[model samples]
Target: MIEAIIHGVILAFGLILPLGVQNVFVFNQGAIQPTFLRAVPVVITAAVCDTLLILLAVLGVSLFILTFAWLKTVLFGIGFFFLVYMGWVIWRSEPLKVNEAEATSFSPKKQILFAASVSLFNPHAILDTIGVIGTNSLGYSGEEKWVFTLATIIVSWIWFMGLALAGRSLGKLDSGGGLMKRINRFSALVIWGVAVYMLTKI
Candidate 1:
C-alpha cells in the first residue's frame, strides 16, 4: 500500500508539475476572482474528472491500449500535437479578466462545465492519466494497487484544491495582474516541456 501511494504521488506530480491549461486557469482564476468561494466549485469539478480517470486506470482498461504497439505510437503523436496546440492557446491568452461581478456571482455549473471541457477533453491530460499513469500501474497488486490508485485521485484533489486555496492569498497581492501573467507564462513552459518529454520518451 505504501509503495502504491508513493507511485501514485509520483504519477500525480508527473502530471501536476506541468505548466498546463489547468494550472494556468486555476492561477488566473485565483488571482482575479473571489478565490475562497470560487475556487471550490472549480477545483471540485476538476477533481471529479480526475477521479474518473484514476478509476478507469485502476480498472485496467487503459492499460489494454498500451499493449497495441501501433496504437501507442499513434497516441503519442496525437498527444504531442494536442499539447502544442494548447500551448499556443495559453501563450496567446489575454490576462484574466477581473470582473468583480463575475467573481462575486460565479456560476458553479458554468465553472464545472468549463473545467470539464479543459481537463477531461484535453488529449494531453487524458494521455497523461490514461496512457502514462495507466501503463505504470501494472507493476502492483492487491492493496498496493488500490492505494496507488487512491493516491493518484487524492493528488488531483489535493493539488488543485491547494492551488485554488493558495490563489486566495493573491487577494492580498498588490500586483495581481503581474503575478498571474507570470504564472501563466510559467505554466506554458511546463506544458511545453512535458509535451516534448512525452513525445520523445514514448
Candidate 2:
C-alpha cells in the first residue's frame, strides 16, 4: 500500500508537471481574482474534473469511450477552437488593478465552464489521464488499487490549490501591473501554442 501510494503520487505529479492549458487558466484565475477564497471555485472545478477523469480511467470506462475515433476528433476540434478563443481573451485582457472600479472578474458559472472545457476537452489531458493513469492502474488490484487512486486524487487536489496560491503570491508581488501584463501575454502565447499543437495532432 505504501508503495502504491508513493507510485501514485510520483506518477500523478509527473503527469501534471507540464504547463498545460488547465494549469495556466487556474493560475491566471488565482492571480486575477480579488481573493484566494474567490478563486476556490476554479480550483475545485478543475480538481473535480480531473477526479472524474481519473475515476473513469481507473474503472475502465474510458477504454470504451476511446474506441470511437469520431469522439477523439470531435474533442480535439472543440478543444482547438476553445484554446484559441481563450488565448485571445487572455491576450486582450487588461491588467487587473487592485483599485480599478471595473476590474474584470469571472463569475462562478464561467469559472466552472472554463475549467471543464480545459480539463475535459483537451485531447492531451484525456489521453494522459486515461492512457497513462489507467494503464498504470492495471498493475494494482484490490486494496492497492484503492490506495493508489486515493493518492492520485489527493495529489491532484493539492497541486491545483498550490498552483492557485502560488499565482496569488505572484499577483501580490506584481502590484504595479507591469509584471502582471507580461505574465498574461505569456500565458496567452502558451495557450495558443497548445492549440496549434493540438491542430497538428488532429
Candidate 3:
C-alpha cells in the first residue's frame, strides 16, 4: 500500500510537472484577476476530474479510450483545434482591465464556472487524466488503487490551489497595474507555447 501511494505521487508529479494548458490559464488568471479567491473552483474541478479518470483506469475502462485509434485521432483533432482557438483568445485578451466599480460587484460563482470550463475542456488535461493517470492505476490492488487515486487528486488540488493563492500573496510587489500586465502577457505566451507543443504531440 505504501509503495502504491508512493508510485501514485511520483506519477502525479511527473504528469503535473509539464506546462499544460491549464497551468498557463490558471497562472494567467492569478496574475490578472483581482483576487486569488477566483481560483478555488478551478482547483476543485481539476482535482475532481483527475480522481474520476484515475477511478476509470482502476476499473479497466480506460483501455478502450486508448485502443480505438480512430477515436483517439478524432479527439486529438477536436482537442487540437480547440486548444489553438483558446490559446489565441488568451493571447489576444486584454490584460488586467478590472474596473474597481465592477470588482465590488464581481461574482465568485462566475469565476468558478470559468475556471471549471477551462480546466475541464483543456486538451492536455484530458490526456493526462484519462491517458497517463488512468492507465497508471493498473499497477495497484484494490485498496492500494484507492490510495493511489486519492494521492493523485491531492497533487492536482495542492498545485493549483497553491498557484491561485500564491498569486494573491505575491501581488504586493506589483502595486501598479503595469507589473500585472507584464505577468499576464508572459503567462499568455507560455500558454501559447504549451498549446503548440500539445498539438505537435497529438
Candidate 4:
C-alpha cells in the first residue's frame, strides 16, 4: 500500500512536471489576476478536470474509449485547432495592472470556460494522462488501486495550487507587468509548438 502511494506520487509528478498548455495557462492566470481569490475559478476548474480524467483512466473507462481510432483522431484535430486559437489570443493579450485588472482581466466565467477547454480538449494532457495512469494502474487492484489513485489526485491538486502560488509571487514582484508580457508571448509560442506537434499526429 505504501509502495502504491509512492509510485502514484512519483508517476503523477513525472507526467505533470513537463511544460504543457494547461500548466502554462493556469500559471499565466495566476500571475495576471488582481488577487489569488480572483484566480480561484481557473485553479478549481483545472483541478476538477484533472480529477475526472484520472478517475476515468484508473477505472478502465479511458481504455474502452481508446478502442475507437476515429474518436482519437477527431479529438486530436479539435485540440490542435483550439491550441492554435488560444496561442493567438494569448499572444495579443497584455497583462493588466492591479488597478485595471477588474476592467480587463479574465472574468470568472471566461476563466472557467477557457480552463475547461484547455483541460478537456488538449490531447497531450489526455493521451499521456490516460495512457500512463491506465497502464500503470493495471499493476494494482481494489483498495491498493484506489490508494494509488488518491495519491495521484492529491499530487495534482497540490501542484496546480503551488504553480498558482508561485505565479502570484511573481505577479507581486512584476508590478509593471513587463515580465508577464514576455511570459505570455513565450507561453503562446510554447503552446503553438505543442499545437504543431499535435497537428503532426492528426
Candidate 5:
C-alpha cells in the first residue's frame, strides 16, 4: 500500500509538473482574480475534471473509449483548435489593473466553463491520465489500486490549490503589470507549443 501510494504521488506530480495549458489557465485565473477565494471555482472545476478522468482511467473506461481510432482523431481535431483559440485569447489579453472592477471579472459560469475546457479538451491530459496512470494501475489490484488512486486524486486536488495560492502571491507582486504581461505571454507560448505538438501527432 505504501509503495502504491508513493508511486501514485510521484507519477501524478511528475505528469502535472509540466506547464501545460490547463495549469497555465488555472494560474492565470488565480492571478487575475481579486482574491484567492474568488478563484475557487476555477480550482474546483479543474480538480473535479481531473478526478473524473482519474476515476475513469482507473476503472479502465477511458481505455475502452479511446480504442476507437475515429474518436481519437475527432478529439485531436477539437483539442487542437480549442488550444489555438485559447492561446490567442491569452496572448491578446490586456494587462490587468490592480483596481480592476468586479464587473469586469469573469463570472462563475465563465470560469467554470473555461476551466472545464482547459481540463477536458486537452488530449495530452486525457492520455496521461488514461495511458500513464491507467497502465501503471495494471500492476495493482483491490486495496492497492484504491490506495494508489486515492493518492493521485489527493495530490491533484492539493496541487491545484497550491498553484492558485502561488499565483495569488505572484499577483500581489505584479501590481506594476510588467510581471503579469510577461507571465501571460509565456503562458500563451506554452499553450501554442502544446497545440503544435498535438497537431504533429495528428
Candidate 6:
C-alpha cells in the first residue's frame, strides 16, 4: 500500500509536468483573475475533471473506450479544433487594452466551461490518463489499488492549487501587465502547436 501511494504520486507528477493546454489555461486564469478566489472555479473544475478521468481510467472504463478507433479519431479531431479556437482566444486576450479588470475577469460559468474543455477535450490528456494511470492501476488490487488511485487524485488537486497560488503571486508582481501579455501570446502558440500535433497524430 505504501509503495502504491508513492508510485501514484510520482506517476501523477510525471504525467502532469508537461506544459499542456490544461495546465496553461489554469495558470493563465490564476494570473489574470483579479483575486486568488476568482481563480478557484477553474482550479476546482480542472481538479474534478482530472478526478473523473482518473476514476474512469482506474476502473477500466477508459481502456474500453480506447479500443474504438473511431473514438480516437473523433477525440483527436475535436481536440484539434478546440485547441485552435482556444489558442486564438488566449492570444487576443488583451487585459490592458480593455478595462483591465473587466477584460480579465471571466465569469464563473466561462471559467468552468473553459476548464472542462481543456481537461476533457484534449486527446493527449485523455490518453495519458487512460494509458499511463490506467495501466499503472493494474499493478495493484483491492485496497492498494484504491490507495493508489486516491494518491493520484490528491496529487492532482494539490498541484492545481499550487499552480493557482503561483500564478496569483506572479499576477501581483506584474502590475504593468507586460509580462502577462507575453505569456498569453506564448501560451497561444503552445496551444496551437498542440493542436497541430494532434492533427498529425490523427
Alpha-carbon local distance difference test for all models: 0.69, 0.87, 0.64, 0.87, 0.85, 0.87
- Across residues 116-170, which tens digit of lDDT does each residue of candidate 3 receive? 5445455556667777777777777778889988888788778877776666565
Candidate 5 C-alpha lDDT tens digits along 1-202? 8999999999999988887888998898788777888889999999999999898899997778678877777777788888888788778876566777464345678778778877887877788977799989889999999999999999999999999999888888888778878888898899898888878767
Model 1: number of backbone collisions: 0
Candidate 5, residue 57: how far the Cα is off, in Å? 0.5
Residue-wise C-alpha lDDT for candidate 1, range 1-202, written one tens digit per residue: 6767888998898888776667765655555464467667788888888888778876886767656777767766765665666566556654444444353323567556556656765556667788777777888877888888888888888888777767767744634466666665676676677568667756
TM-score of 4: 0.95
* Lowest-sum lDDT 10-residue window in model 5: 97-106
**What order do candidates take by TM-score, descending?**
4, 2, 6, 5, 3, 1
Q: Which candidate do you rate higher for TM-score, 2 or 5?
A: 2
Tens digits of per-residue lDDT for model 2, 114-201: 8898899887788998888998999999999989999999999999999999988888887777887898899899889989988986
lDDT of 3: 0.64
Question: What are the clashing pairs of model 5?
Answer: none
Q: All predictions: root-mean-square deviation over Cα?
A: 4.6, 1.4, 3.3, 1.2, 1.6, 1.8
Task: Give me the displacement of residue 181 in model 2, in angstroms.
Answer: 1.0
Could you estimate the TM-score for every candidate?
0.69, 0.95, 0.79, 0.95, 0.93, 0.94
